[model samples]
Target: MERLRRRLPPLTALVVFEAAARLQSFTLAAQEMCITQAAVSRQIRQLEEHLGNPLFIRNHRSVALTTAGQRLFGAVDESLERIAQASTEIRGDASDAVTIAATICMSTYWLMPRLDAFQQEHPNVALRLFALDREVDLRAENVDMAITCGSEGQRHGVRMAHLMDEELVPLCSPAYLAGRVLREPGELLGERLLNLDREHWRGFNWAVVDWAAWFDHMQVRGTLPAARLAFNNHAQQIQATLDGRGIALGSPRMLADLLASGRLVEVLPQRLNTRRGYYLAINEHSTRPRAVAELQGWLERVSHAAMA
Candidate 1:
């Protein structure tokens, strides 16, 4: 048994050897495995040592497998491929769970409000929400779906569905706007402007929207006072605006409740189109499971209704 244990190659070494042998190039195998070519060479050497045979003949710029290496590669490659196919099939048929990734502010203000309805409608579906600001790799993260804010660009193997075009409008506490009668967008230049800090505004390059951008977009001239207070989260910024702190550039959906309750009022009717917008993303390699499909449908419906 001890001799057999010594004869057996480590799983990592086997994986490296199989990849290198099949591709006939350590460099290509390293690229596929996301490791250095040196690492792949070391692993294959270790694998050869375990089997007590030299696996490959290293030429000036290429490697060719030995007769024994070719035989082992054929068996190992087929075995690993079968294992991968089985795992994928099993994961696809998993019926009890669905995982979704969304931003913190969207999860808090948007999804949380409507998720109960989804639960009640689809009682058997166990839903998990991962609230994060950073974009997650759907396949790598095992996420069934994700909601992201940005322009659609080079997402390698993901399908993107446009959710909505986000528009930013100036908002302030109703009390703050009550006595002060500012007719046009220019008037807001004199009032205090509250800025949501850089973290929440990542990918939004317009510093003018950070008090400077909004004013510039409105074509308002003249110097303005610095931001009265800066918040890392939109929720806090909205709360401050509600408390009559200052005017803020608010997302139409984020301040829906405050607008309905008359706590916040639109400072200007004109809205600026932001470069960023919300989107639904799914892995192209995987079909949407039933629960994930249902959730996606529900989100689209809710977003459309909100916009309407």
Candidate 2:
């Protein structure tokens, strides 16, 4: 072991090389390592001398990784990342933030309003919310858990616990319906309808429920009205509704705060159950199951209250 250690290049030299290879600039590596640029250059030269091979090809104003540098970088970068993760785990701070991947609508309308109370109750348990429309790979993204909107079998390799089944109901801001009345479900045909394009999604075999199904379920026949507005997702759809853009189909459980605050109103009592639902997907490597489980429980309570 001693002989092998003596034969190997210095660990510091490898560290310097890793940074330089990643940044592709001695100056940037120096800034990252809090050392002079000359020091980084010297370390790289020493490493090359030890290995009998050049790792970087230095030009007048730029540096590029040599074939050898690329080979070493792939391993070194992965090793350093693993080391950092291990260090974090060893520290084991109770206040370490757990990351949650939330959908656009869920993050904006449903989860945001309830987050403050969760923080207040568990001050030591920190939280981080990643809001994006696309479904994320939990393990690859280093996310602890996710709030997904789809059927139970949409995602694989992760266990899901149903938070709430999304019920489609038409909603509009009070201003949008001013001087207009909705005596029945069909009365909304005269109002400007906000529709989302589900054509791209129709290509996938996922159980995506849309407006046409809802209209058919309500028994409202052909040639109702043209869409006055269109949106890509429920988040923007709800915002447009709030801004009086048009009447949008929304989940009552998710839009309860707006309804209670009088920012939005339900168009009619008729609501359709969609194939989609909100589920909590737990990562296989997640260490903070208790924190995520608490959040799941809180959501169940909130959804029930909203429906009530």
Candidate 3:
């Protein structure tokens, strides 16, 4: 075995070669390996020189694996995958973390507080959260589940569970209402509105769920109050509204605690019953791994309790 090891190709070169062959692009393999394309080509050249056989047939656009390269690629790909699977299986129980991709606001306001409870119950099951406002494809991103906003299941074969259908209403700090006679939804048009600009922004595209839509829902129509302030993210808007900067259209799901604690108050009695709601979507397109199932179950329970 020691003598056989001396005859084996360099593992580093093999790794680069496998990536280049599998992806069919040296540049892509380089990107995946966090190295330059030249580095990938150099490694491949070194491997080919050692083997005394050309591995890849380079062309104008991209490179393709030669017959010998294809045979080697098949073996290396399987070997690497097996190694990874074995490693994962061995470490699965001790460090089985559930990767949950959620909205920035939900992660901050909802998940952060409830995460302790989940951890307490499932001490062994580690939790990994990708808190962002961008859309995440569970399959592409390798996330177990995503907390998403939608009316129905967005992806075929993906399992969807209702998380929260929170009432959309105007929110403001109690200080914002000092010396002001607030009556109804229409009255808020005169107030300094903290808007979530969806027209031009990065992150949550909830512009349709704004004051204009709220007004339409309330059966009141008029020119919207000029946004005294606006934030790209609702989490930021929630914070600004909490500080008494202005009135922001907020959700009971995100601001329920604040609303209950008197840190923030709804400006209008009327709330928008939106068709759009937050959902727990799992990549049931494939096998539902136990670790994913464990976290999903806990999340459903937590969500049910919160919305209850």
Candidate 4:
């Protein structure tokens, strides 16, 4: 303990550094830490000085971590998560609330619709859904579990289970397809397409199938048509599709209810399997262990039913 106190940089500075490094933006780190951008910068500078290594490559509009920065961040983030978990356990939190984080589209289109059954089954457990368009630190955010789309792997202090593979098909409102005879992929060139911007999705590590990728997968050989509508997130793009604006690539498993209800229609018999999959990640040291376990079991059963 004495050695740690002497050797470790200030915990506050480490917190600021971790936020800035994880976010890759001093301004965002400041906003999250509830401090000024200058304060964040100063803490980062002090930490770098303490470690005798440059931590960040400051850019005109952004920041990138130096190798040293990445290394420190990996250690700091995991350590903080462990500390937080230990503290929570020590406190013996008695809340029965279970929080699950997921992508906005998955929450809105898939999980939200099916939550009633779970609620009915366990009336005493309160469920909170944290829906965001971007990935988040599950332990840092105090999320008991998260449904994410990515390759299967162990994240820091988290256990992951494969939920389902993402299956995409061309979808549009029935009104949009009424007048169009899209017998082949090439015929789609004439129609207005709704798309999620690939550039916007890069940071999230999502498996984004842009128009070019979809066209190439379908073996359509020509200059693909420009998207008439591009959304920064899936929810907006899906809304536009539902409003009969344009056709979009969407998951059949996630939107199965919508398709069955005739709110949307599949445009082609073929499908694109992006090879990416949705995963359920649970914080192994959650305070509400029983609640988390119950939700995890329910999610696995529901997802398996969907895939079946």
Judged by lDDT, which candidate is best? 4
lDDT of 2 by residue, 230-276 (tens): 66676888898999988888888888889989999988889998767
- Candidate 4 local lDDT, 185-274, one digit each (tens): 888888888888878888776757777878888889887777767888798888899999999999999898999999999998778889
Clashes of 1: 4
TM-scores for all candidates: the values are 0.67, 0.67, 0.67, 0.78
Least accurate stretch of 10 residues (summed lDDT) in model 3? 199-208
Model 3, span 1-308: residue lDDT tens: 99998999999999999879867998889998899999998999999999999998999998988999988998887787567556556666335567788878888878788889888988887778899887776754557788887675456436888888867888889998885768877787787888877765544434347788888877887888677787767788888988889888778876677888999887767788887788888876323378678888888887778777
Quantify all predictions' global Cα lDDT against the true fold.
0.78, 0.80, 0.79, 0.87
TM-score between model 3 and native: 0.67
Choose 1 or 3, whichever is better by lDDT: 3
RMSD of each: 8.0, 9.7, 6.9, 4.7
Clashes of 4: 0
Which of 1 and 4 is the better model by TM-score? Answer: 4
- Please, what are the lDDT tens digits per residue for candidate 1 over residues 1-308? 99987766798898889778866899989997999999998898888877889999999889999998988987886677567547767776456467788877777777777789989987887877898866686764667788887776656557787777778998898787767777887777778888878765666422325667776888889888776688876777777888888888887775576688788888888888877778888755444466677888888887888888
Candidate 3: where is the Cα deviation over 4 Å? 1-95, 154-157, 179-181, 201-207, 285-288
CA shift at 178, candidate 2, in angstroms?
1.0
